[model samples]
Target: MILILFFCFSFTVDQYIENGRPSADPVVVNPVMEEFDPTKKPEFIIKPRKQFADEGKVAKFKTSFEGVAQVNWERHGQLLQQNDKYKMYPALDFHYLEISSVTAEDAGSYTCIVSNDVGSDTASAVLEVFETFKPSPTPAPKKLELDVKLLDRDVLEGTQQVEFKCKFSNATTVYWLKDGRKLTENERRKMTFDGVFAMLIIKDISCLDIACYECVATSKRGEEVRTSCALTVKRDKQDCNDETGERSKAPEIVSVTPSDLSVKSGEAAMFTVNHTGDTEVKWYRGRREVEPDDRLIIDNKSGVGHFTIQNALPTDQGVYNVIVTNKWGNDSMLVRLHVEDTSIFDGRDVKISTENFEDFYILQDKVGKGRFGTVHKCIEKSSNRLWAAKIIKCKEKQKPDVRNEINIMNGLTHSKVLRLWDAYESPTGFIIVTEFVCGGELFERIVDDDFVLTESDCAHFMHQICEGVCYLHAKNIIHLDLKPENILCIAKSNNLIKIIDFGLARCLQPGDSIKVLFGTPDFIAPEVVNYDEISYATDLWSLGVICYVLLSGWAPFTGETDSETLVNVTQAKYDFDEDIFEDISELAKDFIQKLLVKNKDHRMTIQDCLKHEWLALDTVDGQIMKRLSTDKLKTFIARRKWQVPTPASSLKQSNGGGPSGKAFLNGGADHWHHSHHHRKGHMQTPRSSSYSNGQVPWKKNGNAIQAVNRMIGKFSSLSSNSSISSSSSSSPTSSSSLYSKSKQSS
Candidate 1:
């Protein structure tokens, strides 16, 4: 009976639904979406697409949502889904902005968009950054000077607002001096405006007002400009409320930073201040008094006392107290100090922002560092973006070096060359901000390892690098330094390679012969060493060397020292070991031989190398020669031990500037690893019977080394214009996209 009633109820409900029983009133439904083509509507826009610092330090973004809907705030990219209600969020554009934290990393691209049932519009803006300035240079005083003329002795009694003023003509920033040391930003009762002058308003004066005081003045010129003055406050004897208590004896003078405060912990810190007082000055390590030993010398005239531990160690960390004694009173200052390794990086002073390791943060771990400073990973602090930071320490005499790198990088826009996103200068070093490549160095991959790069793969990678270098050469820029260590490679899909590292590069000026032998000897062309006359061809020689090394696993020439290498170079030694060769293609062998020619004039140019049948060979995939051009090798290996060609002589000039490490002209050797040769005896040159008239004895054992050496020497004598004018390449295409689009070298 219950089952039957349930079926009856269900049937009654179904009948009611068929009879159109209303639940909430009938809703109107659109038969169709009216043809409101958003693309056909007037483009919506947000004003002030970027955030602007409209008020002091505050930034504002003005937005206008004007496309058929009343825009509401979209909380985290969500639209209000209620029917018949236009609940949309306000869009942010470049000009109009929503306020967020103006962090150092907040400097990035921001976008805003407006949308309705009919249409939507979008806009973007870049965030420009600025910093809030603070007092840069801090000052410390040696003594307090009093101006009796400026004193108001008439206001002499207790609890009176007596004011003290110290004036200096050269001071832009002034700090209240407590005792002898200048007050810091953390000190109490200090206030200032634009870092001009600090005023300490001591509400009520008492017997203690007789204390000595100093005022330190610091110029805005940062760390260099500073001055100080000292003064004494006086009052009647009755102001000495200490009269009611047992008075202690006054103390003597203690040491200061510049004077008595001098320090020599391996190297002295640039920052220091002076110290002085009344009673006998005695240094103490906490409760233990330090005898005035030889290491603790104090000069009364300078009020400076230099202190050094007999042997500084962990036990030296403690509270140092200086007891000053005089007839009036005994004053003591206890300074808590902790000393560790002096070389500890003190980054706080520079105010460099390096926090994240994602998208442009600083790599503080410092994997390795050199003359250019340090290299580390960087992440964007705000967005957590990652980058590589090359911290180049500024040479005091060559401050413009950093700016030169920045200028060059800022103008470069290439996909193969690492892109520079940002740069900044800190008090510590010049930060070269670049995109991070995780693929490591190419030498560490295929060439340095057992893995091999097929001819086409090699061509693909080399072609890209050549393209980038050619672009630079056309701009008259010569990469003074090029080597495996500096070349970076990464595959986008297991095949792409990118060459980087322009640290030692310089612009090739008109009539500017390379006057400095900066590159390593193995890669250094003959002319670069002998006459310091380098052109784009010098870099070309290095590129050839790179290619040869990659395929052959060794340089063309090698020796135990730079001298032997130079001699070999002079002899024009070609196949030092032909027996060590693998079954490589004759085309490949020919191309390598052409590029490695002892004469720079005869070396195959980049274009010629690319066009060579060796590079045109099909890849391992059996693709056609044309299709093989795009193949990239993805393997990675590392070469830690660099082989630098030893110079012919290590002799110092008779004038005597010490032993010479720099080589103006080196020969007879080139960098080669130990395993470059096959097992057993050195390989002999394969053939020489065809070309030589037998006059030069061109074949093996016919002074082949001497002939090659002379060829290199001849190259050193030839001028650049005379040599490159006959070079085999002259493509003028400036951009890759343009080249592909036109399929022509303009």
Candidate 2:
């Protein structure tokens, strides 16, 4: 045996050297473990201690769960791990313990045995599989919503079904809590319910139930998983007294409203504020104290506090904050107030006025005072009609300029001049609603009709004006401003002219001289230079200037410099272009020269113009130039209005110009008669109401006033005719002849 051991030791040294292992001092192993003792009994015991591992991946922890108990893994109550849990005989020794294919089921109580040649012992251990995924934590409210509409509802209102869902995802189950108590405790009838979420069925919840409400969700593992809300149940039964008794003693703000935004510096701002939960409600501005007046004002009148800021100054322009203090807490809200300068208006600046465009359109403002109001387009709501509303800015210290314009327009019943329909006043300003001419201004038509005009075209346009203005002059009204832009062409109509912008017009007595300087600079008459005195002849001078521009297609005396032009006008000197003279005639020039004299006294009277050569029955190259074919004139008006003249119309065009067999192309005889009668009336504006006194009192209060004055004017004219009839029997025949001529032409 000794000789065999020595040979074995030498062989072990040679093997270690071949394997390249560092040599160590000879150390004894648990020598019995190196070889199997076939004749002796052996035992197996699980190594280490009890084991734990994740259920899903537990098999990776160990092959057969090497633990003190030598557990045999089991799954679904069946053995799966490579371990002999079903049968293991320790008396028959086994040295190599091996296992294959482990599973979570392998984790369980197991036994191991240790045996020697004489006896064997056993040890047991238990292995457990824990979860990697933990139970969710309890969560907070994800949403916070207020039920402000509750205040408008009746008491004992059943719960508006609401769903409180927890977003604690990955959690197996969710738990709900509310107001420091778990909502899991469902009440008998009016219970807090749980389906997909937690809900409180507020059965007959009154004001007493009003409180801060929220929710939270927890997982099965006692973890919060979701958020809730800060719910407020504004109970219906809650009042100031009841709220004070049931809840904390804090003040609360209610609703507030103000009377006006504008007040005098020393005036008061009236307001009302509603409150609850406060013993007393007070008001303030910034840091300054402002108190409510009334020694007998109740402290609990609907919980509303009425306040007035007396003698409010400019410094009170900031926020007016009101604080209500109750036993619970404080509540406040801020309001803004403004003070204005009250000296801008006088009481008389405004009047109750109506617009007759559409069934009496009515409004109130500084009608004629604002800059933009100087030119306003008003729509008569009733009729869906459009009207031009002109305002004269006659602020403090300025004479009522609008009165002057209206007086001039009202006096003149002229087709060329815009018709004065009505006048009104309001705190804002004075307003005049005149005839709406959809045709636009004359300058605008010049571009629309294309450049330059033929002599016949000029004659037609200027002749219409002569007729309208002559009617005005017959009533002793002067169109102080007669610029071409003031002349508007009727939209989709004949050669009708609607003169507008009477902002500088004036009415005069026969031979009366207006000593005011106002008119378009280019159109002003020489005699109006000083505004010292100007008569009907001054208008004649401007008329002469107007006709020259129309006939020659340019002003007769235009200079590069205003000074040069004014000097020429003042000197009564001018010459037409020689080049254009061939295109004009002596008759037209003579007509213009007869009126454009420096001395107002030498200006031609309207009657003198009646028999002028150009207006007389003159033959132009054997053709009657004075007569216009009614059929052709109608076609012309229609053509300009976008109507393509059919071949049928051309047949009538061959017969000169006129309305063909269309009869009257203008307004009916009724309108002509009205004009004829108005032609006889002595017209006046509100500015001359003082002059008329009781005889012709026309006011500018409203549409009713204007209508009344127009009637009175008609009667006055009828009365005046009686005197003319007695003075001259020939006058009636002459008037009838003039009316006949207009009828035939139209």
The candidate that achieves the highest lDDT relative to the unseen native structure: 2
Alpha-carbon TM-score of each model against the true structure: 0.37, 0.35
Worst 10 residues of 1 by lDDT: 724-733
lDDT of 1 by residue, 143-204 (tens): 33222212222233245454555444445665665434455543223445344334444435
RMSD of 1: 28.9
Segments in model 2 whose C-alpha atoms lie over 4 Å from true places? 1-359, 362-376, 382-384, 391-394, 447-452, 510-513, 530-532, 616-746
User: Alpha-carbon error at 708 in model 1, in Å?
Assistant: 21
Shift of residue 333 alpha carbon in model 2, Å? 68
Candidate 2 lDDT at 406 equals 55
Q: What are the candidates' C-alpha RMSDs? A: 28.9, 32.8
Candidate 2 lDDT, 1-746, residue by residue in tens: 54454454455445333334312221111112244343444344333246666655422221211111222323344443333422221111111222223355556665444444444444455666665666798685343322111111222324544333333333434344343345544342133324343444444443333332334444455555344333323323333556445534454556777623567643446668787753577665434455332111213355787665443444445445565665444555555577764521122232325443334654322212222243344554554334455553334322344455555565444445666556776554555665444444454454443333445555566666677668777777776656554566654223557665554456676544345423433466775433336666777787788777655545655543333444456667787777645546677788888988878888888667765666552344443333222332233333323433222121111112111111111111000000001112443332212223333222211111211122323323432212100010100101111111111121
